[model samples]
Target: MEDLMQKATEATDDLYRIRDTYFPKDVNHKINTLQTHSQIALNILDSIPLEERKLATQRATYEYLRGKILDVFEEYSKKAEDHLSKAVKLNPSLADAWLCLGNCIWKKGDLPATRNCFTLALSKGPNKRILSQLSMLERRMAQGAENQEEIVAESIKHAKEAIALDVKDGNSWYNLGNACLTCFFVTGAWDHSKLQQSLKAYQNAEKDEGMKMNPDLYFNCATVNTYLENYERALSGFEAAALIDPCLNATEEVKKMINLVDKLDGLLKGQIKAKRLASLTSSLTEVQVKPSYKRATIDNLLDGLNKAIAVVGKVLFFIKHENITPLYYLVCDSNQICFVLTVYGMSNEAIKEGDQVTLLDPCFRNNNFSWNEKHYELRSIRVDFLEQVQVNGKPIPPRHSVRSSIYAQHKP
Candidate 1:
């Protein structure tokens, strides 16, 4: 028994030297030496009677040994939780032990439980590093909640606090970017001002090399570009992100947009052709003629012109049903017998020969022309009647002056 006590006292002294070397600053040679001493100390403790052991001395010694043992096996690929739990049992007030417990829980994917453990560690000692990590878990949990607005607001608040605590924290910037994006998603409005703020936050995160490895940052940049209508830039961003994570939805969305743009290009080309044809037809009937005939003959020609203008106007109205403006010019032939309608924009159908037509004062009000300087030309035409006329290969009528017969007839 005397010999055993001597060996145990030597082992305790070795354990103290090892503990001093292992903590605050680790040295490999000292750590290896410490591990050997720790095994011996455990053996000695096992042999000594619990009641006989000096309680204060034994507690201090056990606390030191527990910390050193945990450090030695910190990153071992085994049941780390079991080892950490044992250290906590030995010294419940060990703040570092609680931090290690939180990390193990995070690794096991119990995020909520891990968050609770981290909170406890922070309560014990408000370590900035642990608090930052806890904020990250909270941000993620908020993202998965149904009330996204409230979640994002809370997440932004936490991220700001984390940044205040550690301005250089890349994770805090990342969380801020996520919170801004979540705000955009919940609102469904791409407010450029808000998005610009989000872009700045993302830029800060991108400065950290490790952040580039995360596909989420790239995907988010692509989403912002898409909102800005920078299609080419958005496509390139999504492509790079897809290379990192092929299963990302951004890859498919970019592909779909590419196809949509192609279809729109084709449709736009067809519309251009239709617009050109309508303009050319309107320009062909510029000359108007007035046949010097009897009052009855003049009446018949005026009636025909009115009827033809009305019919053509109806056709023009249908052609431009979806257009913003409905104004058009009519060119009558020199003989005052034939006319062509001109529209401002593209029309699906070209003006063809054999179509019936009509004419009306462009600014006619209540069946009477209004002499407004802005629309003087459109108000000049007096006839407002429909005519059944055939389009044929014939030169347009010569330009001749025609009096407003409708006005003369209406004069009281």
Candidate 2:
């Protein structure tokens, strides 16, 4: 009986190991291995003496191990739930069984019940793993709540608490980074400081060797870099994630970014819009910058603030994008150099193609990179408010400048 119990423990440990570390191209292999180990563990437990199994502690262990193996598959198994419930009833102090029960209930979409189980597990003791799971649960809950910001703040707090318990735990740092990234998007996706904090946490997570196995860390880190306009890092990070987990759409993201850059290059190189560009530039008149605002061009502009500067450009193409913030346009300056101009908090009717526009206090970036044997470069300038732009040499009317919509389209 002792030997059989030892074998059962070993099989259960194997299930946990595989559940934690296995990420395979073919999920069937993983599933098969888990099923095999689960059967072995169950058989060993069943072979134990009936007298020994009658003991409360022994019965709880048996039920918990069986339930956990089913839960390890991440599918909602009725048998798993029944066994876990029995285990917790047999021994109320079984924190791990409660954790397994919580996970099982989560799959059934009983989020509040799942939370109850997690809280019960935590009440038994402070477990870093349970705290991290609760943090994730908070973020998921925020998705539907009207007060999303408040809930995400709670998520960040729990993630921080987990890290405080085990500072060296890579998974906790990764969870913290995810929580911060969630905060960034939930609060309007305009906070650069939140993005920076997320990136820093992901960087710290990378210092731990175990985190390298988590493809989401790479994918999410790349997403933050993409928003920050660190294009090269974003590309590499996505590529790394794709290599690790082929199921992710990281490769598609790479292709989409490359395609956008290619389209920008085509529009800027005097291809489809050359005639319009020439005609617009011919009628362009000199516009004076305010004394406080200096004059600068795209090539000389730097990342971040090009503060107190004016850049004059003619709208050449209305850039199209899916529902995302900050409308985009391909524009050409008096020097005939083309760059993307992004406008936020302005209505679509506020500006039109061929309008001679002045950008005040512009934010800028010059992105250059090589991917998949192709080189790409793009220059961008951003105007955050209608007040920063003058159309056809005059400020826009307050009525037309109201932020009524946030979508982009292209029309000649």
Candidate 3:
């Protein structure tokens, strides 16, 4: 009998070691070892004399080991329920029995039952750790609900409660930031004020001061800045984020955004010229149209004005939807003969000022005349016609076309 009791004690110690070492890293392995040890201990208990086991020391040890084994090997639910029921019957005041039962139910993923058990455990004493963990689980469950806005509000409430209980918890702050960012994205506003607020909360996480060093935060900031059309700042922020931790996915996304910003910058320069032309034409129409003009001639001019109106309409539509701008420039020679109509904003330069040129279907094609030195690229010119006139006896410089090699080199 004494030998059997000794074997039971050793088996209990082995079970405890398995729980301490394996339970956290691997619940499955811990459960297997625990079941093996518990069977051995139970067989040893059966062999011991009844009178010997009934003593206070032996009875307490048996009950403690039984509860712990039940807690670990939860798959033996029926057997564990039987053992716990018997233990509670024998000792009504055993707090450990109640706690173990509560944890077992938690492992089964029965939250209401688990919360009841935890409440009972807390009834016996104030357990700060258990309370904190329960709050976190509650927050997770709340955030997983269907109504996203309500879930976010509830999550924020729970996170605030967790922080109130333990001010230094990094996870609580991180979770709060998640809730805020979700709200910002769902609204689709990309409001900088709201994002900055969320970022500040994440920055306050207690695990490390280097939460600010996290690449995700910087990438988010870059996206917001890009939406705000602060392209230069967005470019720099994305570059810094990619440098920190160049995951393949993030590297590809940042490269794409950088390319987009470069294209937008070029498109903006072209649109500036278009806007200037629009403004100039508006001013000219106000000053030049007089009531004394003949009706027939005015009607012809109105027809030409309607055509010009259609071109501006197309340009505006492309600018808004496709990020494209149309260019119209006239180039003349020393003899004041207009020889070229250049359009510069397409993927290719349509015409060079010195080239022999012919207009066909709104595009310029080559003509028979040889190129000349008296030609220069106009920086900004619009659709209005110009008559060639000699000025200052100086020959124009040869037009400089933007080269394909330079375009490829400047591309990110």
The residue-level lDDT of candidate 1 at 134 comes to: 63
- Candidate 2, backbone clash total: 0
Residue-wise lDDT of candidate 1 within 1-412, one digit each (tens)?
Answer: 3354456657765675444323222345555776677677668655766665455444434444343344443354235566566556666666666766776666656777777777777777656566556655665565445664565566567667767776766666776776665555444332345466666777787788656656677777776665444456667778877766665666686766465334322232334344444554453343232233111111133421232232222122222222122122233322232222422212223233333233332212111211112111111222211112112322223221121211111100
Give the alpha carbon lDDT tens digit for every residue of 162-272 in model 2: 999999999899999998988776655556688899999999999999888788899999888877778789889999988887777788988876666677666656554
Question: TM-score for all predictions?
Answer: 0.42, 0.85, 0.36
Predicted structure 1, TM vs. truth: 0.42
lDDT of 2 at 87: 96
Q: Model 1 off-target regions past 4 Å?
A: 1-112, 124-132, 143-147, 188-192, 244-253, 263-412
Full-model lDDT for every candidate:
0.48, 0.80, 0.45
Please write out the lDDT profile of model 3 over residues 1-412, one tens digit for every residue: 5677677768766776555434233445556677787787777667777787786546655665565565555453655655655665566565566656666666667777766765665577644444544544454444334554464455556556656766676555655555555544433222335556556556576265534445565565555454333445555667766765455134565565455433433343343354444443342222221233221211122311222211111122111222122233333312222222223222223333223221111212221111122222212122211111111212222332221222221111
| Cα-based RMSD of candidate 3 | 20.1
Best of the candidates, lDDT: 2
Off-target runs (Cα >4 Å) in candidate 3 are 1-146, 188-193, 206-248, 271-276, 279-412
Model 1, position 153: C-alpha lDDT score: 69
Best by TM-score: 2
Candidates ranked by lDDT: 2, 1, 3
| Backbone clashes under 3 angstroms, per model | 24, 0, 0
User: Candidate 2 — which residues are off by over 4 angstroms?
Assistant: 1-10, 270-278, 281-291, 321-327, 342-352, 355-357, 382-412
